[model samples]
Target: MSELAEPTVDPADWTCPAPLRDQPVVVMGHGGGGALSAELIEQVFAPAYGNATLAALTDSAVLDLGGARLAFSTDSYVVRPLFFPGGGLGDLAVNGTVNDLAMSGARPAYLSAAFVLEEGVELAVVEKVARAMGAAAEAAGVVVATGDTKVVESGHGDGVYVTTSGVGLVPAGVDIRPQRARPGDVVIVSGPIGLHGVAVMSVREGLEFGVEIASDTAPLADLVAAMLAVTPDIHVLRDPTRGGLGASLNEIARASGTGVRLSERSIPVPDAVANACGFLGLDPLYVANEGRLVAFVPPSAAEEVLAAMRAHPQGSGAAVIGECVAEHPGMVVVATGLGGTRVVDLPLGEQLPRIC
Candidate 1:
């Protein structure tokens, strides 16, 4: 009989303490939704400001007045290459907020947008952004109930920055949160990754891939409806936008205090995106995807829900990439192609700053 191999070693034996590396500076990693991001929140934001509202960690604070639950989420868009292959800042600002609301298992119905335009920014350009916003709202089946616009000196702000706040209603008896993900749950990606980041980067850098690779920036209200229709037991829903799939998965694992095991071979990455990542020394898993979502569902319902997702246009490339586990709590590990395993920790720093 062959001898059994020794058990795998824990990462703590070698991993360094994250806080000691950076003492005072606020680096991009603090916003990357990985370990550093959590550190900043726990050390700076949560401690300096202690309140019941912020501690909930919900996408929106919930009020308990006669038992009606309302969801609110706000996001600021500062995407470079304001106009990219698949979308522009205007559409992104609207869709991004809508998706954030939907991720909370809420039906997005209202939005408030604020825009900061730089001086000398032509009126025609501003009008173009307004038109895009209207179209996006119509497509998502949401309304821009209120808005404000401001102009700043050219040197003070970027070309434009949009802050969008959204409100929605969560149906009774439905609960979805990152901390709710549990062992034996299945993980699903709505579609491919890296397309949006690569597309935006290519445009900003003037790199060509012989074919246009555009941002996958679209609202997820319809997709969410279909998903909840099939299985209302979804534990978590997140869009791996700014830090991509790697960061999102890491966050979920940490939040739920569970181990996540993913099969790298199962992830759906487009050919154009894979090529672009290779040429640019980037990992497709760490690239942003504006139009995709990650879902955590009961293992038994995974196949049925995956089929339903694949039937939708936004989730045509849907796949079951991983499952939650009990070991390695608060960490995520992936089975690489070469029969090796590595931790898919949150990125330590920004791979491409200001991409979004």
Candidate 2:
């Protein structure tokens, strides 16, 4: 038996896959949902778990079951500080998943909450987070029907990490997806950019502007429903979270093989956010927004959709920021204030990490 146990392993016997070869170890960017994250999903995960549903890569999986269409989505929250200016991990967990379903033109109905708690974290903090989630679910008009809990060693886990999954019903006539974006489509943003990211960064780093910037951590399901009431033919819908508006546009462009031309001056950047980004050498375009959405509508229906968005409180500050073009397919270009055009490419990594 001792002689049979003697065996050797070859150095060339082990190697990394294409996606992991370049970076042998996972980095923060992998979770930041940028270029590296795209590679991980498209190359590694997709191939490993190949399927039509996963390949589509929409915010939610729109499935046909029992003669009805259903939208399903899941997201995890690891924002630092647990509590931020306008929200905490609990509400973010609920709102993030709800928005994902809404992106598919679905009316969210139920959610499941899962928590990973650190061993030594205060029980009061957990109670507060749970309460916040209940309030957010009520506001979003969704129910937390099921839940789970787990505990990790104190050092292994942060205070708490919340993961939420949501299910919604997609109206029969509605069909929205990034691949549906077309040339001559109008690109509209729901509200100001950079608020959620900036708000979290300010508190984490103790940096401040003259005024406080609050996180826009509200639900957008109601807003989506309102827009659908006007027209169910919206080409695309996305909440610019990790990679922000810049990344969201690039993704849609790539998926649809279209070009987007943005008016830099037309994009709404709040004064507080603008000032803070400038001081910190950051681009407001690449900053994350939790409670905002970017919609692409056909030119013929743009006006009606914009009006519908405006009528909703969540989309009060909506604006037409750009248009999809046919000239340079699969690219994003911005008309700068300097009377020049520049490419607004997807970032390689995150500028601010763990904000969402």
lDDT scores of the candidates, listed in order: 0.84, 0.91
Q: Highest TM-score among the candidates is held by which one?
A: 2
Off by over 4 Å in 1: 1-25, 28-31, 52-66
RMSD of each: 9.1, 4.6
TM-score of 1: 0.90
- Model 1's alpha-carbon lDDT is 0.84
Count of clashing residue pairs in every prediction: 0, 0
lDDT of 2 at 45: 86
lDDT tens digits by residue: candidate 1, 1-356: 34796555454453433562444455556565556666776767777788656654554554554577887888888888789898899889889889888888889899998999999887887788778989999999999999998999989988888899998888776788888999999999999889989999999999999889989999997898888888788899988887789988887888799999999999999999999999999999899888899999998888888998998998888999999999999898999999999888778655776766
